[model samples]
Target: MTLAIPDLPAVLETDRLIIRSPQPGDGPDLFDAVVDALADLRQFPASLPWAMEMPSVDESESFCVAGSESFQARKDFPFLFIDKTSRIVVGAGGLHRPRWTVPAFELGFWGRSSFVGRGLFSEAADALVNFAFASFDAKRVEAICDDLNVRSIRVCERIGMQLEGVLRQERRAPDGSLRNTRIYSKCE
Candidate 1:
């Protein structure tokens, strides 16, 4: 059975960040961020294909609209994480691709190249995980990452999501090679 949307605040604030839904005019800000982080993002070939080339402003706005619509529909929970003080959109992360039948959401994230060393994504993940459980009564929150992505694995671990197992040769990599996926989950 699909779970109904739960009541929650539109914006969530952590000590150093503010997490919120994507807005209509976020295209330019998003365009700048991806442009700034393109090199770093390209490292994960399968993460975002659009990052291969810079998107036009219209493309970015369309992405924002889609995210906003899905969020409003309670189909996916998306968030943009900004530095509370600097107000820079340092990173984006979300509880996405949810299976409300199982009440599980997959976590994914990315940070601007300049913010990688910092723990902003980790902080935001923590907040989102908390909200997912407290607000949505999720039975499981999981993160699936390429087995080779040590950085992503670390983020999942940092948030206390236990390694469930590895799915061998389950996906095709960005370079056309078969890739393994590491599954991590926090269960209620």
Candidate 2:
């Protein structure tokens, strides 16, 4: 279920980071992270479609507005991950509950290339999973990744999500090659 950013306390906090709503000022940071990690991101299904299709800064600004409004309207909860120690906006992630999925939400995340090996996605995902099961009253949370994305698979595993199944040749990448996808799920 899409959530309006609740007035509840911060979504998640670890010894080194805080995950919170993406603010207006984060557009540049978001852009930079995405651009910097384009090559790495292109290898994953979740980001391949957008890795090379960057819009103008003005367009990205508009997107941030829509994202914020959607978040506040209880339609989705997208967050920017911040390195508390350095005050850096290093990545973004989110939970999306489509109306058709009533009690379930899917998790999506990505990080700065430099931050990938530091366990940021794992910590952030664990935090989101907890928030979904606890505060959102979610009964299930799912994460799907390209079959070849080992890093993402590890993150899902670290968060205790069980490998559910595989979708055979579910997607055709930009290169027109078919790709299988792995699905992981956690049920309350």
Candidate 3:
């Protein structure tokens, strides 16, 4: 069964991070993080189309506001990952594309370039996966990424998600070339 939005925890804590839903004032920090990681994000245009263009601070704020609304409506669960000690937004990720009927969710994540190689994204992602299973009673949690994204693949494997398969020519890359997609999942 699907849990009501009110029943969902808006903030989830880890030993070193605070994973929470986006709020109105989060735009500045979110903008900085996105800009810092823009080049890296642009590498997978098909997977991260939103990163193709630089968004204004207002646009980022709009995203936060809309994200909050989506969270409240139970349509999506976008989150910001903040460092516990520094209180800085280190990354962003969440369970998206929910299929409440089967109680499944698609996990997605990305870290600021400065925070890369720190394992913070992995920590946040693990917490999200656990939250999906525990809080949402999700029967299946999956992550799909560009086949060439080694870091993302490692994150999925590190969190014990098994590689289901790769979909050849699943989509087109930014350069108009065929791209493969790797699907990973942890199922009940």
- Report the lDDT of model 2 for residue 172: 86
Query: Each candidate's root-mean-square deviation in Å?
Result: 1.6, 2.7, 1.4
Q: What lDDT, from 0 to 1, does candidate 2 have?
A: 0.79
Cα deviation in Å at residue 75, candidate 2? 0.5
List, residue by residue over 64-116, the lDDT tens digit for candidate 1. Answer: 78889988888887888889998888878799988878788988787788888
- Error of model 2, residue 71, in angstroms: 0.9
lDDT of 3 by residue, 2-112 (tens): 446448876899999999999999999999899988999899988989999999999999999999999988899999999999998988998899998888999999989
Q: Candidate 2: misplaced stretches above 4 Å?
A: 1-7, 45-47, 99-102
Kindly list the per-residue Cα lDDT of model 2 for residues 1-188, writing each as its tens digit.
54453464544787777888775766776777776666788776443576657656666566677778877776887877888988777787788763435468889888888888998889888888888877777888899889999899999999899999999889988777889889999988
Compute the lDDT for candidate 3: 0.93
Best by lDDT: 3
lDDT of each: 0.83, 0.79, 0.93
